[model samples]
Target: MRLLLASLILLVFIPLNAQTTRKYSNEFMNIGVDAAALGQSNAVVARSNDVNAGYWNPAGLINLEDNQLALMHSSYFANIANYDYAGFAMPLDDNSAFGVSLIRFAVDDILDTTQLIDEQGNVNYDRISLFSTADYGLTVSYSRNLPIQGLSYGVNAKIIRRIIGDFASSWGVGLDAAIQFETDNNWKFGVMARDITTTYNSWSINEEEFAKVQNAVEGQNQELPETTEITIPKLQIGVAKLYRFHYDYTLEAEIDLNVRFEQNNDVISTSFASINPAFGFEFGYIDMIYLRGGMGNFQNELQIDNSEQLTFQPTFGVGFKYNGIQVDYAFTDIGDQSVALYSNVFSLKLDFSIFR
Candidate 1:
């Protein structure tokens, strides 16, 4: 473990410059909520050691000895609360590992309102109405070590749902895959692919909003219209490398590139390709205390339209381990030098194990 700690310090001070390019949709709603999944966002990723390897990289979990479970939460930008993730892994009798995990992203108490206009095209504030929105996802995953000497693999399937303030509710499915390679020298290589389907669903406007708008149309007293389908983002790919230092510390770096491709590629915009690069260091004292720091692009969106508004240039976190259990936390801020939408985020995680 001391070797892992040394690697963490070396990577931070070494100043090795690297650049990554990726394709991603600059959409605000999608980016803000799923930020954590793009990479191993919690400090627990470091403290739990190889327990989260199925979500981060299945191959990494191959080296684990204890059975474990964990939960994590993120306070997102724009007054939104992101998801919670839980995972468990156990060692088989033949030196193999098996694990399962569930992930859920949810938001509550969102304000739903409508635009009010006066007859003379002036302002009308008295007519505004309020409602709320809700979105959630549930993912289940399984992973195991391969018979191959140094390979591991895992997969996750999910169901997603969205409701926009008495408007409409939509549902969709998603899948994620991960693989990892480890060498005797404590070096590891990993890859993950997420949202392979480019999930799609639709929601109707709030009933109140729809009625207000419909009534405003000069001669139309029409019935409420049908809901519309909204498309989410597309496939995302991530690659990472880890070097273990002395003790139980590690230095890891990863890059995630996402792209949006529709059935009609000709109309697709080049901006669909977006990228996020993560460089992080984890320090562990024995098998318990941990400290982490990382810097990355595309961690959060500060502006609704400017994709460059991705904040979280640097992040720091800490974790505690006791009796085969772990707790983690991370803090992030958006140095939005140019907008009122500037914000900060906090995340927490807990891990427990039942040895079998």
Candidate 2:
């Protein structure tokens, strides 16, 4: 455990200059997965205990005494995009566990007008084509319970791939480390380092595929170029406490703070501002039914001008469990960044004890 902690510190603080111009490569990996976590505004780093913990805080896997499988689907931007996730976890020994998960995000049937040209001067609709863009990730995780009664540590290795209509593609890999602690009084704390080794995506472009577009436009001399982008490391901290009440009811409240390290290109700002905070609450009855709500993406008033406004994305969800099976549904307001649309996520999970 001591060696693991030392390694995590070194991985996070290693000196690597980040690219200033290229930002957010393979961003699909940042999108939160699973209805249960998204419903809590992604504030479950401290409370995650299901198979989805492989994506949230891998250290939470130590809390799982049973083998579990989880599957989720979410529609974004009013059905324009689809995001899916699947994960499985199993206890490897009395004090250690392993998990694997896959994520896919895709946008299909986009009209490709780059080749819309004909011998005649008139535009030809028949020349138009349709294409799709997709991103995929695979994560392998392992967790071990420390000698301390309530402390656990975990690590994840992830591979990412992206494809754009058969014209371009990219591949990358990264690492994540996490630690969690729970007290006998029902208080939990967690810390996670995302992209601890820094993620790098090397893009390969096929310039020949865009010859038609270059020919159709006058004075167009641009060509696709191979490039690489780096994703800076991010740190997340969370704390939660659970309250038990009469009638077999329990309530949990949590808050998370996320800090991202990257360049601030705004000429007006003197330094980088990369802090984001979120809050979530959940209520459960008989440990079978749950209600959840949360909010995230908050910025200080000083960060915005008169022309710009801050928007808070709110989320709500519900869950049901019966006979070792669980189903969850979540609704989120995606705001107007792209399209004014709401997102709905649904997930199913099954659990069975390995020892039994």
**Per-residue accuracy of model 2 over 1-356 as CA lDDT, tens digit each:** 32233233223312244332355565678888778788889898998877888999999998887899999999876677789999999889889999999999987777666556677766888987777777899999999999999999999999999877656778899999999999999999999899998888887766666455456445745444436767778888999999999969999999998777753422122345477788888999998999999988664333335454455668899999888888999988765223467888899999985225
Ten consecutive residues with minimal summed lDDT in candidate 2? 6-15
lDDT of 1: 0.49
Residue by residue across 1-356, what tens digits does model 1's lDDT show?
A: 32233233223312233212113211222433212332234212222235565565454555776666556656454645455565667666444666666555444553222346666776677755544344565555565678776667766666667654454556656666767666665455556566655544443345664565445545645554333333444443444555666846656555544344433212123444544444556656665776666655433443556543344456666767677655666655543223434333333333334342
- Candidate 1 stretches with Cα past 4 Å from truth are 1-54, 58-66, 78-83, 86-107, 110-131, 202-209, 216-274, 298-312, 334-356
Query: What TM-score, over all chains together, does every model reach?
Result: 0.62, 0.87
Measure candidate 1: CA RMSD. Answer: 12.6
lDDT of 2 at 298: 66
lDDT to native, each model:
0.49, 0.79
C-alpha RMSD of each candidate structure in angstroms: 12.6, 9.0
Among all candidates shown, the one with the greatest lDDT: 2
